[model samples]
Target: MAFHTRSNSFPSMPHPIVQEVDEHLCRLRSSEAASTSSSSICHKLSGLQDLHDCVDKLLLLPLTQQALAKEQNKKWTNELLDGSLRLLDVCSSAKDAILQTKECFGGIHRRKSLPISLLVEE
Candidate 1:
């Protein structure tokens, strides 16, 4: 099933970076049903990476910089910053966990491929 895209609903959000991020999010959501496979996980991770790249590009825009500077002290701004920090922390932790799991699995595969004699030697 196809997921609804929110970009059209947000006509005021004309920036290309915002649109790119929205597209990535929509694609990720639409593919959620097939998320059982490693390839699907990789696709979702790539989408998230694209979203982060879009966010970095958005931050580089002069308009974005000015708006952030203009409202840096507002409550909403503070909340946004706090939320972004939390997201960053969660992403970092997730990356670490994924790496650890991958390493563990790699070791398992390596052990499984070893000759029986080599296994006994270990």
Candidate 2:
């Protein structure tokens, strides 16, 4: 990446790609700030648990009403009665990804401790 100027704003127009990237970076920084606000992994996992509870509550709602709540996929006709099940699917995928990452790092920590064990044996 190349830094073109002090700012991306132009008199008549803006650089769309740069603007999008900057917005994404800002969001990332905000999320980083939020995640770093709590140092405990347990806290974050508890948050995930809370999300799961919300999902369970959501499950109590009728499928048609649930689909109607999601505006992005709502159609003009009978489909308006339908709910986008994608929300649960996406959330579950994200949860899986987070757990996978935790497992990967846990394995890495165990691997790092192997040398310490070898040192102790020596």
Best by lDDT: 1
Best by TM-score: 1
- Pairs that collide in candidate 2 are 67-82, 67-83
Question: What lDDT would each prediction earn against the true structure?
Answer: 0.77, 0.54
| Model 2 C-alpha lDDT per residue in residues 1-122, reported as the tens digit of each score | 99777765544754444454455545444555464422344455455455445444444556635664677644642342232345456557766876888899899898787877665653
Residue pairs with colliding backbones in model 1 are none
Candidate 1 residue-wise lDDT, 1-122, digit = tens: 99987655545658878888788888878887875655666667777778777877987889777777785557766886787788689778767877887899999999999987988854
Model 1, runs deviating above 4 Å = 1-13, 71-73, 115-122
What are the root-mean-square deviations of the candidates from the true structure over C-alphas? 10.4, 16.3
Error of 1 at 106 (Å): 1.8
